[model samples]
Target: MTKVNVIGAGLAGCEAAWALARYGIGVRLFEMKPKKFSPAHKYGGFAELVCSNSLKAARLESAAGLLKTEMEMLGSLTVPCAKANSVEAGGALAVDRERFSDSVTEKIRNCELIEVIEQEVTELPEGVTIIATGPLTSGALAEEIRKLCGEGLSFYDAAAPIVTYESLDMEKVFFASRYDRGDADYINCPMDKEEYLAFYRALIGAERVQLKDFETHPFSVYEGCMPIEELASRGEDTMRFGPMKPVGITDKRTGRRPYAVVQLRRENREATLFNLVGFQTNLKFGEQKRVFSMIPGLENAEFMRFGVMHRNTFINSPVLLNADFSMREHPDIYFAGQMTGVEGYMESAASGIIAGTAAARRLLGLEPIQLPKDTMTGALCAYISDPFNDGKFQPMGANMGILPDIGERIKDKKEKYGVYARRAVDSLQRELDRIGCNSNS
Candidate 1:
């Protein structure tokens, strides 16, 4: 059997290792915890979620939901682990972080083909390897990656803050997910019109931490979790539509949706920690306390983690790598996760799966699996490898946007999404069959 080395035991790394092992490839998985730690990592756990627990959505009609369905069809462990430790959050799939990581750790350990190496890798080996070290990769290793990718490497990236559950003013907040659907795992802080306006004003005016040479390097904020201050700058109502949207949540005190709402979610299995649902930030520490406290229920909120931004590193995948994530320059090496420019947990895992499978195939003298473009996984690969910057090539998440738009535009959003999803799955099945994979054979 051929040996494949995978760096980083985070979501992407773990998934990559599992996929390769499944293909009968021996995998050496590297995790830099206990031996070394990132600024955001607290636990010595593998695949620790430094951000939110929510894995986007589980609804088949929604883009994220559809992507997850594709992952399941590909035999994803992340999806099953998520289901086992999942906390209901309406249509979305949110997991208990500890349990989720533990589950990933357990699965990898139990796999006979995988060997878990709890050491930080400073350099890549000469043989077939997949780099999935994620965003918080150590400075030394990041530099090594930069050496490999030539000019396309980045460093600074920001993570959102998490709060201690005990710090929340529960009396002023209510436990409810959106639309009162699923488990009431989210804590909502309702704000009347006047209160929301005041909070908005303070947020926009709050001071931000300055970075050295801020002009040369550019940073892009994650869409799902925008910094509160950035949201405020967009417009007073931006929050109302984005994070603070009062659509599905009803304020029991008013018997109606509040003018705005701040959502806090349980971050761990202990329920002792909570995260600001969409409050990723770059505000000064003092500014965070001053501005965030303006919210109705966060008057005395104790923050466990403050949002900090860092530079994101990624190569121009379209120009650098094939669909399998192996570089055109060097077929021996492969890149996965954010470095490959595939954003979000599911997308990252998908990249790992493809890369790992391809590496195994190369080793086993089998052909690489080229996923059908109609599948979410295939669409993502196409997006990354499109090579058409078109004046802008920001990293993209798997969404219906990447899907070839339907010729007949349906008026109903839900029904339209259903049609796209059905077509996508059907196309995927055909491609799988072409690749000699049968659903039940």
Candidate 2:
């Protein structure tokens, strides 16, 4: 049997290994956990989610959901594991973090075709290999990756804080989606004009954690995950136009549009914990509690996790990788996960599925799978690998805007998204069948 090496045992690495094993290829799965750890990693398990547990929205019309559907069709291991361990967050798929990691770790360990190697991999191993070390990749291995990819790697990403559900004042917060488009999944903390101004003042005035001299780099915000405090400092109304925008939602109590709203998304299935949506921050812990409490419903919020910033490394894939995630310079070497610049959790796993399947097919002497661009996975692959974006490439998460616009101009957003979703599913299914890959398997 052909043997393939998979590095990092994170979400993308696990998916890559699982996909290879599914295709009857032997896998040497390497992990640096238990023996060594990244700054963000705590759980000694494969596929540990270091940040938010929620995998984003679960509806097909959403980009994250569409990418997940494609992963399932591609015989994904992480998506299934996540679904099995899911916690309730209204329309999104949030998992019990520990249990989710445990599930993936158990499956990988029990797979007969996989050999688990728990040690830090400082050097890239010989033979065909897949690197999925993710954004928090550290130490000597990250050095090796930097050498291979040149100067295209980055090292800073931020995550939002989580609060106990009991801490929120229900009277001040109401559950609702924008325009009631989906289920009432998000808890909205509505604010009047005066309240908005006061909260904004506090947020802008909060003390932020100072990075060490060596840690200081020109902070480039990934547009999608902009820190709340940073957004606030942009301008007085910058936040209102961004995450705290209150356009579609009407406060039930007043039956009027709130001047601003802070939305809390469920972080687990039990609905016991909720994270402030789009509230990623780098404020000092005490300052976070002091300033964040200024929001209407969170005056006494019991914070479970305070927002923190960390370095997230990624390669400039557009110049180095093929659409299938194989290195253009060395076809035998593949990269997956956030390291490949596919930003979201499921997007990383989806890339792993592609890279693993592609690697397996090459080892088996089969033709490469050319995914249709209409599919969410295909669009992401195209986005990351297109050399046109070489100089301007930033980490991209799954979003409908990345997909090709529908030929007909449909004014209704939901209907247009529905069409895009249906088209992607059909296209992906056809391609999978043509390649003799069983989506259900």
Candidate 3:
């Protein structure tokens, strides 16, 4: 039987190992936990979510939701596990972090085809291998990856803070989605112009945590996860236009849209913990608590996890990888997760599924799976592997902008996105059939 080594037990690594095992391929899964932990990690389990627990909007028309739907059709391990552990967060899929990780760990451990190896991998192993160490990859392993990918690596990424729901002033906040489009899942803390300006001033002036000398590398902020303070510094109204924009939501008390709104999303199923949506930051913990409390409902908020900034590394996939995530120079080696430049949790897991399946097919002497370009997963693969993107490539998450626009114009944004979602699902189904792959496998 053909055997493969999968490094890292993150979402990508576990998914990759599971995919290979599903195909009757033997897998040696590596993890460095309990023994070694990254600066951002505390859990000793596989597929631990170091950032926010919410998987983003769950409606099919939304990009994150569409990508997740595609993953489910591709026999994803994480998506199903996440669903099983889901908490109510309006329309978004949120999970109890510990339970979610425990579930994935249990599934991987029980899979006879996959052997879990608990040790830090420093050097790139020989033979068929899949690397999915994720963004916070550290020590000698990061060095080995840097050697392979050359200068195409990043080191800075941020996460938002989570607060206990009991601390939020319910009288000052209300639950509602923009335009009432989805379930009233988001908690909105409305702020008038004066409150907005005061909070904005405090945020921009708040002290940030300083990076170590070795950690100080030139960084480009990925637009998808831009830090809240950094975004606020761009201009007085920059934040309002970005995360705090009060475009479609009306404050129930005043029956009018406030000047700005800070949205809190559920972090787990119990609705006891909520994170500030789009509020990734690097502020000092004290500064975070001080400045963040200026928001309407968060004035006395009790924090569960303060927002943090960490090094996130990724390769120049356009130059290094094929659309199937196999290396250009070495077909036996593949890369997945954020390291392959697919940004979100679902996107990283999707890449793992592709790489694992691709590696399995190669070892079995089966034809490659030709995913349709119209599909979300296919488009992400295309973006990362297209040679034209070499010099200008940036980490990309699933979004409608990456998909080929429908030639006919549709005035309604939701209607247009709905069409994109349906088209992608149908196209993916056809491709799966062509490759003789089972979505239920």
Candidate closest to the true structure, highest lDDT: 3
Model 2 residue runs over 4 Å out of place are 156-310
Error of 3 at 36 (Å): 1.1
**Which ten contiguous residues of candidate 3 have the minimum total lDDT?**
212-221
Model 3 bad stretches (over 4 Å): 156-310
- Candidate 1 residue lDDT tens string, 1-441: 667899988888888898888777899888878788876677777778876798987999887898888877776778889999999799899999999999998999899999988888988876889999886678789889888877666443555566655557778899988887999988999999989888888888888877544322545555654667777798779989988899999997878888889898765334655677778788987888888888777887766456766566677777788888898889989989988878788889888878887887788787667787767889888777766642223466776656665678576768988998999888877777777754232
lDDT of 3 by residue, 1-441 (tens): 668999989999998999999889999999999799986788988889876899888999988899999998888999999999999999899999999999999999999999999889999888899999987687698888888777866554777887867678999999999999989999999999999999999999999987643344555458978999999999999999999999999998899999999999865434656789999999999999999999998989877567877666788889989999999988889999999878788889999999999999888889889888789899889889988667645566776666766777776768988999999999998888888888666
Shift of residue 147 alpha carbon in model 3, Å: 1.9
lDDT tens readout by residue for model 2, 1-441: 668999989889999999999988999999988999876788998888876899999999877888888889889999889999999899999999999999999999999999999888989999999999887676688889888878867565677887867668999899999999989999999999999999889988888887543334545557777889888888999999998999899998899999999999875444656788889898998999898998888998877567766566789888899999999998999999999978778988889999999999998888779899889899889889887667655576776766666778776667987999999999988887887778554
Candidate 1 positional error at 366, Å: 2.1
Ordered from best to worst TM-score, the candidate numbers read 2, 3, 1
TM-score for each predicted model, relative to the true structure: 0.68, 0.70, 0.69
